[model samples]
Target: MEKSGENYKVISCGDVASLGRVVLHDALALTGAEVSINELPAGVSVPFVHAHKNNEEVYVVLSGKGFLFIDGEEFAIQEGDAFRIDPKGERCMKADDTSAIRFICVQAKANSLEGFTQSDGVLSETKPSWL
Candidate 1:
């Protein structure tokens, strides 16, 4: 949903950072998946390792650096890095005292894909099909 002249909702990263251990969800309306902005202060991590029973999550790092521990493996992640984990995997994140971390986490049920076809490849009704 647009607000006034804007085409989409916007949330300030600076505004969110002030609140520690915060994850902002449903900031924008959507049909297929849920989204959240996750922030962690230095030396703190999401308190528990989580494994979702019905949804898979993709984490996109927006800033800072951290270790993403999934099961028993640790992967270093920094800005612009993105990773997806299955519903059965145990995962969590941690940021050291050196810097804070912010990221976008999007979740949806596994194997669910939503799409629409405006045109079909070989049909006249599909004119301008490649648009």
Candidate 2:
């Protein structure tokens, strides 16, 4: 599907992987807010402990068991579990050993890499920084 103002595309899990498709990517609002729907395969991790200078994000678990590591703290998450992180905090997540973790990640205000950098002085998103 297409939308006005900015680019809007329907990406599946299959697009991100192979089996499932229609997942959303790079859907950043004019306000710099970004939204994405991700469908993780049976075993996948959400990536590394990256921090955003001015973007607070929330993760809502949709299916399967979930595991999240925020600033070195580990957590056991399940269906209906929601994890929220503030800007400048190091965070990352992973899927359970037996099942995949499907979740929607939402970022408000500082969605763009530029905006995030402007919010704080950071060279890269992968590096550790404080807000």
Candidate 3:
């Protein structure tokens, strides 16, 4: 059974995997959505290079430099770069031999606009309490 509570999920990239690359799945709890962090070693590319049938994705580059392939086209990416991919677009990425790549990938059903907007978020006054 699940209960309401406040918790923190602290993780380190090395903790997820020690291989040349790693994909940390469901790093955070998000309803109707998915989040993952990918760490790619130099010159290594993601294994999955296919398109999704129903979900679109956003890639946020956290560190290093790399190249992204979308729909058979290539684009250079770097730290602080963010881009979206349509569900029907084929995608993959590779890190440069000089630097590794760390990025976050968010995925959600394309039709669920409301879900992407965080409409379910609640704003409430904090309960009266003394520290």
Candidate 4:
């Protein structure tokens, strides 16, 4: 499901409770980032190891167990784990034999964040409806 207005958009990914990938770039008309929800079944690895030319990626593990391989090193990941990889780092992921793994990956240009949150937000006089 999706809804949009002049400056905002809301989308529902439906049920992400199974093994699959959901890429949100085109769905949301994103201009600056690529985001995807990925799920891997037990004992399965991503089809290929990859590195981005200009974008760094952050992954947040939402459920299950997995191993993240980055530049020849392996790190165990599970629910609530989050990590970032540099643009050129080789990376791949595999779900453990006993559990499927689901994660969200957010990719954006390397070194592109100029300001965030406190430094970028302004106090607006308009109040939220809940207030």
- Each candidate's number of clashing pairs is 0, 9, 0, 0
lDDT of 1 by residue, 1-131 (tens): 23433455555535668755334455555556777777888777889999998899998989998889998899788989999999999999998678788888988899885443644234555457577
lDDT of 4 by residue, 1-131 (tens): 78999998889887676628889998899999999998998999998999999999999999999999999999789999999999999999999999999999999999999889999889889999998
Model 1 spans with C-alpha error above 4 angstroms:
1-14, 20-27, 116-131
Candidate number of the best TM-score:
4
Q: List the candidates' TM-scores in order.
A: 0.72, 0.62, 0.75, 0.94
Better of 2 and 3 by TM-score: 3
Instruction: Rank by lDDT, highest first.
Output: 4, 3, 1, 2
lDDT, candidate 3, equals 0.79
lDDT of 2 at 126: 66
| TM-score of model 4 vs. true structure | 0.94
Q: Clashing residue pairs, candidate 4? A: none
lDDT of model 3, residue 7: 63
lDDT of 1 at 49: 92
Tens digits of per-residue lDDT, candidate 3, 1-131, equal 23335764455556433554444454445666677777788888888898999999998999999999999899899999999999999998999888888888888889777642367677667765872
Clashing pairs in 1: none
Q: How would you encode candidate 2's per-residue C-alpha lDDT over 1-131 as one tens digit per residue?
A: 44454444332333443433232434322345556666666667765679887889888887888678888899898889887788877987777878877777878754445534467665645655654
